[model samples]
Each structure stands twice: as C-alpha cells, then as structure tokens.
Target chain A: MQQSQAPISSSSAVNRRGLRPRLTLLLGGILGIILLLDLEPYATRWLQPGGDIIFWDLHFPRVFAAAIGGIALSWSGLMMQTLFRNPLAGPFLIGITPGATFGVALVTYLGASMGLEDSGTSFALQPLAALGGAMLVLSIQLLLQKKLTQLHSLLLVGLVLGYFFGAAVDIITQTAQAQQVKQFVMWGMGGFDRVLPSQLILLGSSALIGLLILLYHRHAFNAYLLGDIHVESAGKSVKNLRLWLIIGSASMAAIVTAYCGPVSFVGLIAPHLSRKIQGTESHGPNILTSAFAGAALTLTADLLANQLIPNTVLPINAILSIIGAPVVIFMLARKD
Target chain B: MKTQRVLSAITTLSALILGLASCGEHPRDANKSDIVWIKNAYATLFRVGYSGTDSFLELYTDAQSKKIAGAFHWGTSAAIQGYEKLKDRSKIVSLSAIHTGMLAELNAHRHLVGVESRKYIAHPLLQEKSTINSLSEVAPDGPILPEKLAFCNPTLMFGTLSSIEDKQAIERQAKGKFSVLWCNNHLENHPLGRAEWIIAFGWVMGKAEKAQGQFNTVKKDYESLVVEAKKSAGTHPKVITNCVYNGMWFVPQYSSYVSQFIRDAGGEPITAENGTGSNVVNIEKAVGLFSEADIWINTDLCTTLNCLKSSDPRVQHIKAFRNGKAYHFNKQLQANGSNPYWDMGCIYPNRILSDLFHIFRDDLPTDSTYYYDICK
Candidate 1:
C-alpha cells in the first residue's frame, strides 16, 4: 500500500512493478521500431563525408523533432490530467496551446507589421513569448478554478480563454502582410519538419527540464492524487504544489507548440492511453508509460504524416486528430 | 485604301514569318473576302448563336478584359475596359456593368442598358472615379450570370480560366445562342506569345490583316528593345520579383513572362529553382534567395519602400533594399485604380523591357517609357 502512497524505486519493487517495466519496454520498443523504420531509408542514403544535403538537413532533423515533441506534449498532458484531476484536461483543451499560439502569432504577424522579417531572428524569440502567453492563460484558468468548483466549468473557462486568444490572434493576423499571415496560418497548422537543427537544442532542453521538474515533484504528485486534503495532510502546500505543477506542464506544452506549431490531440490522447496500459494511479509508472506512449504515438503520427504523401508532409495536427479522436471515443465508451 | 496599305505591309511580314504560300491564304476573290475574311489557321471558332454560324461576338469583363474586345471589335462593348482607354466610346454599345458608380457613367454616356449584377453596387475604385454609387449590388463572385448576360445577348463571350465553369453555365443557358471562347493568352509564358493572341482575336473579328500589321509592329519593337537591352548584357544586375504574399514569397518561374522580361532586359532573374512556373517558397527560403539579389521588382501592391519593409522587415536585409534597387509597378494606374502594367504591358512588352533595361543597365538612355518606378 505504501508503494502506492510513496514514490518507489525500481530496486525496491521489482516483482510488484513488473507491468510498468514491460509497459515501458513495449512502448519504448514501438518508439524504437518507428524511428528505425522511418530513419533506415534516410540513414542508408546519408553519405559519410556529408554528401547528401537532403538526408542531413531534412530527414535527420525531422526525426529528432518528432521524438522530442512527442515526449514533451504527452508528458505535459499527464501533468495537466493529474493537476486538474480530469481525464479530458489537455494543453489544447485547456487554452495553454492556444495561448502559446497567440504568443507566436503576435511576434510572427504583429512583429512583421512592425517591419520585422517573419523568417529572421525576429521570430527567434517565439518560445519565450509563447511561454509568457501559456503562463497567462494557465494562471487565469487556475485562479478561476478556485471559484468554479465544477470540472466542466473549469474546462468551459479554458475553452472561453482559448476563443479569446484565438480572436486576438485573428485580429493580429488581419493587420499582418500577406506573407506573414501565410507563415502564421501555416504555423497554426502544426508540423514537425519546421524545427531546424538549430532549434533542436532549445526544444530538447525544454523537454528535459519539464521531465526533471515532473520527476522532482513525483512524490507530491502521487500524494495529490488522493485529494488536496491528503496533500496538505502530508505537510505540503497544495497551492504551491499546484502552481509548480501547472508551470512545469504549461512550459512543456508551450515549448513544443512554439516550435512545432500547436500539435493537436497528442497531449490529450497519450496520457489516457498510457494510463490504460499501465493500469496504475502511481506517478512513477504512469509518467514513464505516458511519456513513452506519447513519444511513440507522436512519432507514429509524424511517420504517417511524412509517408502518406511522397515529398510532402501532411500536417501533424490533422494526422493526430484522425488517430487521436478514435482512441478518445474508445476510452469514453469503456465501462471503467 | 488604308486597310489595303496595312494589308500589303502585313502580307510581307506574314510571308516572311508563315511562308509565302501560307500568307496567300488571304482570300483573293471579292465574294470570298466578304464571306470568310480570316483563314482557319488564325481564326478562333465562336458558337454563333446555336445556328452553327460563327460570326458576331460580344465581350464582358470585371473592369477590363485586357482590352481584348477593343483590339478585335472596332468598338468593344461599352462595359469593357478599353472602350474609354483605347476605342471610340460612341461606337461601342452598352453592356452590363458590375459596379454601380461605373453604371452611372455608363448611363450618362447613353450606354447603360444591361447590368451584370444587382448584388454589388459599391465599388471602391469606381466610387473614387464617379459620383453615381449604389449601396448594395450583387457582385460577380463566380461566372457571369446567364440571366444578366442574356440582356447583353452576346454572340461570343470572352473570359479566363477562372470563369471557365461560369462560362459553361452561360453556354448551357445560351445553348446555340452564343459560344464562350476563353482567352488563354495569359497562359503563354512569353510576352509576345501573349500579345500574339491579339492576332488570333482579330481573325475572329474578320480583321486578320489589321491584327497581322499590329503584331508586326509589336514584334519589330520588342525585338529592337531586346537588341538594345542586350548591348549592356555584361553590366546586367540580378533581379528578383514580387513581394511576399501570405508569408510565401513568389518568384517567377524561369520561363514566366516576367522572368523572360528580366532576361531580355539583360538582367539575370533570381529563382529558388529552375522551375517552369512561379515558385511559392516560405519566407525563410525567400529570404535566402532575396538576400543575394541586386534588385527587386514587382513588390505587388506595396506602394512605398516603407510599406514593403512593413510587410517584412527582413526586406531591409536584402542588398536590393539597402542599395535602393527596390522598384514597384505604381507608375500607371487607371481611373479605377487598376494597374495598367497588366493591361498595357501585356500588349507592349517592348516598353516593359525598356524599363528593365533602364533599371539594370545604367548605360541605357533613360526614357519616359517606364511602367515601373522606384518605391520611395
């Protein structure tokens, strides 16, 4: 029972946590399989002395982006689900993604109107701006959640915030020049291939930081699952824990959205699918399983998006929506 | 006698271009001349009112159908572009008007007989030119309406591919009453190739000799302009065209009209790839291409250098912007705010080439023939 109440290391619970390890390996195996399957052709085409620019510039950067983006969004989704104690809470659903998008659009569209190149270093500060916007929406949602006791009310408020941010983005885009509007609109469509080799370090670092934060609060997360009362009883400030949780989760979502263009449904689908596979409420197995599931799902969606058409990448958001919506329906239909 | 003189001159040019025997296709007998003025080679087929006779033609357009009707018909429908610009307006009959402000002018000129749409009455450009304005008018969003067009009673209708489906609907309504012949001259990648369609149009109007004469002049002028431009080939600058639209920068294909103009003007055109048509690359790729260029031309709809920079500040990063080589087609605007570059330049590519030569080659004599000017 203490194993469920506290965070347990693999050394202390080998036999009892056999499912977690197997689930991790299975999800990890799927991710590996997809990466290898997708990369083998590109890898074979890669010239040793840097002969092929397409292999190096296009394919290699794309693979890492998909993997890293998947991990970040799915892990962020898990954090949001636990923090809100709602199965349906997600970055997109809860206004965090829209806020990040609004932030990027502001710089991309409004900045261009101010005579800044949408393609140049003016767009380089997008992640920070996205983080600010994500935080703005997340803080408002959290503050409103204190008054609105109902889970659906909070979701509704988040949806309203999403609409508001979306309207702001539209207004900003209307004033932008045509090319900037095209860039803004394309960025809204979401794709993995947009991440250049230079952007990978920032994306990878954000994911690593978010994961570390989640791991650091692993114990507090498990305690909070029992309710805010149980978390307080354990001598933790519920408000502080919630704040950190939201910040960590929102940052992860913001970073991914800012770089990859508001990836749809991955944040909502990955955790639920991971929870079903792991079949546990504990943070260690759930988080690991969810992260792997998220990575696997994103990579697979990205692979389908890439391969579905030759030489053209289908939008990642569209592919994810097609794959993610059905799994959500299945989860809702299940008696559990 | 004037027609005979022009015909004789065209006969010489046609003999050189199409061979002597082909030039002799001009009818010799007076009876044949009245019955079939143009030969089948240059003549376009019209539906001719379901009677299977290809004869009379009528044309309608949004503002201007590129002065197409005026070139073929002595006086185009009063509703078309060139009625006032190129033709004797008194000789032209009134057709449907799309803009209400223009409709009042049409009425004042005793030419307001038909209207294409009652849906859109307010036109921003037309409002600026004329006092007669309507609050609400149905604008032609799709093809020319069969009902509105019925009033025009055209034997032949001219339209572009954009209105191909709409033209089909009109064909269905007219069914033997008219034939819609879409002018695909713009599809020609070469400037002369586009202008040469005027000969094809003239043939339809039983004016093949006149069309041939006009085309000969255009050919001679264009070839002379090319020869003048090539003189400064060694000093040609690198030129890029068109500003960013919706974050994707459009560069003319190597074979496009503008690119050909750039080449003939003794300047090298910068393109992302050796594509046959315009390429729409994102801002990043566009920035890379634009940065290396010496001059930028056709920054579409951007009136000033500051406006161009505001569209994308990275425009300032380009050598063209830094060196003040940014130019736009803001020189010749119609009363209704339409760019005559598309209207007039299509007919006179020689002038376009002359302007580019002036821009690219400092050695060239600067003339008042520029269709474009520096974006301040």
Candidate 2:
C-alpha cells in the first residue's frame, strides 16, 4: 500500500563554506583592540615621569597575573572538551573544581581543627590533596563505566560526588576557627591576582602538556565521533585511550581548580563555540580553535574584572559566570 | 592565512617583550649603600650581644658590596630590642615593611621601600607608598624598583613573624643583596615577656639613651601599680576576663592575659582551668561555666558604644547583660601621644594594674564612666 503512495521529492540545502579561521582572527583582533583601549589610561600614567610610581608598580604585577591566568584557563578548557566528547562537559561538570575546593577547605578548616602551628601549611598542601580528590572521583567514574553506558549516568554520578564533597567542606568549615574560615571564603571568591610568578611554571606546563597529549590523539578523537563500538572495531584500544584521556583532562582541571579556585563554564562554552564555527565536529580543528577562543574569552573577562571598577578588581569566576551562563542557556534552548 | 597567523604571533610576542623590557629599567642609584644612614649602632650591639642564631645577624654584618634584601616575619619584641641596642640608623638604606604606627616611632618613614598590606593605606606615609596585600602577589622581578630602593638605601628590613614563609628564600633574596632583620613582639609571642625590644629599636634608630629612660619609667610605673592593686585586696570582688563571645554568653578562659590582670587585681578568676592558648569555646560550654558571671567586658576598641549595642544580640541573654555590667577599655589609653600601647602596657603594667584594681575594689578610684555608670 505504501509503495503505490511513494513520491520522490527534493529540498534545497544551503552550502556553507569554511570561513572560520578568518572569522576567529577578526574576533581576536577586535578583542585585542578593546584590551588596548581599556589599558591605555594606565599606560599613559606609567609613562609620565614621577607621576605616582607606586600605582604603576602595582599595575604591572596585576596585568602579568591576569595574562598568564587567561592563557592557562583557556588551554585547560580545550583539553577537557577534547577528552570528554560532550559539548556540555566542562571542569565544573566533572566535579574536578569542586573536588579541589574540597581539598583546600579540608586543609584550611580541618588543619585548623587539628591544631597545626603553621597556617601556610594548609595552603601549601592543598594542590596535592586536590589532585588526590580528583583521582578518587576519576576512579569512581572508571569503576561505574560498564554500568554507566549512558552519558546521563556518568553526569548523575559526578553531580552526586559534587554534593558529597560540598557537604564535607561545610562540616569542616563549621569546626574551623573564625579567622581561618574567613581566609577560605576569600580564597573561594577566585582571583587571578593570587597567581604568583613562582606558580606560573607549574600551572603553565601542566596545561601545555595536557593540550599536547590531546593534539597527538586527534585521530582517535575523530573516530570517537562514530561512537565507542565503531572505534573499538577499528583496532584501537578504546578503553585504554579513554582512561588516559580522562586522566589527562582531570589532572589539568584539578590543578587549575586547586590553584585558582573553581572557575566555571569556560570548558563547555569554548568548545561549543568552536564546533559551531567549524560546522563540523573534527577534533583537530575544534581543539586548536577552542584553545584560542577560550584564551580570548578569559582575557576579555579578566579585563572587564579589572577595568569595570577604577581601583578595585572583581573575582575572575564572577565575571566568567556572568558571561558564560547566558551563552550556555541559549545553546540549550536552541537545541531544544 | 597561516602566514598571517605567524605574523600576528610575532607581533604579540614583540609587544610582550617590549612591555617586559620597559619594566626592566632599574631606578638609578639603586644600591643599598647609597641611601643616607640614620644609625649604625645596632650593628655593633648585635655583633657583641647576640650569638645564638647568627644566621640572621650574619646577613647584616658580613654582606659584600652587592645589596642584599630579605623578608622578616617574626620576633617583634626581639626586633625592637635589637634596634634599640643599635648605634646607627643611617646604615639601613631600604625597608620592605609594614606597621605604620611603629615606623612613626622609629622616625624612619622615608626608608620604606614597600608595604606588606594595603590595610593601613589610611596611614599618611603608606598612602604615599606602594603596598601589596600578600607576599605571593609580588612579581617575579620583585615589585619595587631597585633604583627607588637604592635612593632609600636600606641595608636591613624587618616585619611581623607571620609574614615569613621561607626564611631561606628570604635570605637568598637578601644574602649578598640586602640584610634582613626579623622583628617579633614579645607580648604577642610570649606570655610574660618584657619590653626590652623598644630599646632594641632605639639602638637601631640611634636613640639608645631615650629608649633606656623610657624603658625605666615604664618598669617603675608597672611595679607601683602592682603594689596599689595589692593594697585594696580585701575589698576586691570576684572577676573574669570575658575575652570570647559565645552567642549566649561571654567566655573567659582562666589562662588568658585578661585573667592575669584579674588575678593581679585581687579577684578570683573563673575559667582558670583553660590553658594559655586562644581557643574559642561553644556558647553552650561558655554558658555552663559562666552562668553567674557578674561583669562582661568587651575589649574591642574599634566598636563604639552604639555599634556594640547594636551588633551583639547575645549580650541580652547573660546575667552580665541583664545587670548592664559591660565595660570597654579605650585602646587610645595604650598610646602616650604617638607611642604604641604595646610599649605602654609592657613597660607600665602598673597602669593596667591600677585600672583593674579600680574595677574590682569598691574603695579604689577610677574614671567617671567606670565609677557612676558601669559599676553601679
């Protein structure tokens, strides 16, 4: 009955040529101009001989910190997007940032409870503790991988881990000294200014190594687009590759989270923007594009954080959250 | 497109290099030896008196022609003592420093190269100088221009005990580069220590005789006050320091500094079982211990009568709150014109003793507020 009723039909489809490289370059140029404009007054002040050297001195360190931090965050975002293969997957989604925060909270609050003479030991020990916490969560995800065939199952597990970590942090904070609690609250607000020159090597190298690793495995990532079984049939050890990718991504995410406090949504939004621009989900193009875009976004946000108020700086996370949340919402709504 | 990307990358690299190079122009005459000296006597004294930990003092005395700089973060009293013993201040050419009130007393305000925090931007000199909130915020090249520091020419620098994280790093930064002295205050660090450090600072600033006389007066006055408190011991009431706020009640540990004052004033102190540590107790624990505490004292000087009246809601729950027996000690009383309360209290414990006696003993005299409004 259906064979008799069948009719041939044709619909016109638009051919969109690749112009993303030029577009990205144009956007980067615009952002650079805006940054220069925002920074001009300080430059002029610094150039003027004997015109408040103190203010000029303060400005240099802050600007350097912001630049370094922007680069690190952007690279971290690119690596995470490539590893997870989920458009919405970011550092915050995997609970790495929260896990790191839990580590710092444990050190600052719990260390105070334990009667440690040196308060700085808490800060010194936070990165290693955070790395341990992130690994723990990663191991849990790996154990549940067989049962958690669906992405939703993995996400739900991550959300539960996040909640568990948050509850533990709150309990530790309650027992801590009021002064120590105040210090933790201030740290949690997240500032690029906190990144010292000494920490730059550690943060910068880890992010670079993670991005390089992701770049080397671009072909495997492209195969991942056809789903796990197809890639497995193509003679690649998909399980081992997936584990390494997760470890690399989680390690990068965990370090940034530990050092800079939890920065949200950059990983998710940057890759999505890159994919939309490329008009294909090819790993090679997406990774490079996402890294550049992430850096640009973070740098611009930091510029706003510093310049929004004349003499004061807002938290880096606050600026990113304001810009990121709406874009994510728009992407989800458009998909729906 | 690839060529353009390369060109843009080069342009960005060149810009960054230019920016960094511009930052590198060191201030002229940036050597530590070039600045005017205020005193050099403290060097002679340290060379003679202190032999236990020569690691710190050796930095000041044995350095070469190159200017050395180190961060000092401990021993405020010891710093004061060392400085007071010093014969000259002029040898100290630059200082990475803080604590404006103490700086004013030393009269070495111009030597400040950098400040540790912006919390005291309200201070006139710091308002005019560069300040960083945290040491971790310092740039790789160091925030202060060597030329500016050279003009100030400080050979040695000092700070509070908490500011130093790595003494070795500080020494490395200053060893053959600058001399660093660690200043720790006795009252903050030690439970029962003297104000010999004031003499130390005087020695550093080349004011040894003035420091000696000031130290003597403080010691003599404290002894007399102790005797006065003892005179009216029979009539003295039971007292507690009430140092901590516990939501429902004021908590007073028997081992706190305030407890020492209460004991010296001839009052029986509750919470004498708690040790000398500044541990905070819960409201429940505080209430259980001091359910019948007669007097509640608020030691915070920044809060005015109105501010305290509004902020402290728990003040209404305790027996002391019901009786309106709360009193505040004025922080300004610790200062004599420009000198710090630390110097005042440590040197003249008698004045504090006298104040405590007046509060506890009905026959003793006190200020009008403590007399008519507070005790009654």
Highest TM-score among the candidates is held by which one? Answer: 1
Candidate 2 lDDT tens digits, A1-336: 211111111121013333667766765676567557645655776545433332233333334444444545555565555446566676677677767778777776665455441223444555567767777777787787656667667777888888988898878776554446755675576654444445667777777777687677666766665567656766777666666666777777776666566666666677777666665566666666666566666667767875685334466778988999999899889869
- Top candidate, metric lDDT: 1
Against the unseen true structure, what C-alpha lDDT does each candidate score?
0.64, 0.52
- Shift of residue A222 alpha carbon in model 2, Å: 1.4
Candidate 1 shows a clash count of: 16
TM-score of chain B of 1: 0.65
**Chain B TM-score (each prediction, in order):** 0.65, 0.55
Q: Candidate 2 residues B101-218, lDDT tens each?
A: 3344455555444443333223333333233221221212223333444443445555333434444445555555555565543333211233444555554555557766765665
Clashes of 2: 57
Candidate 1 global CA lDDT score = 0.64
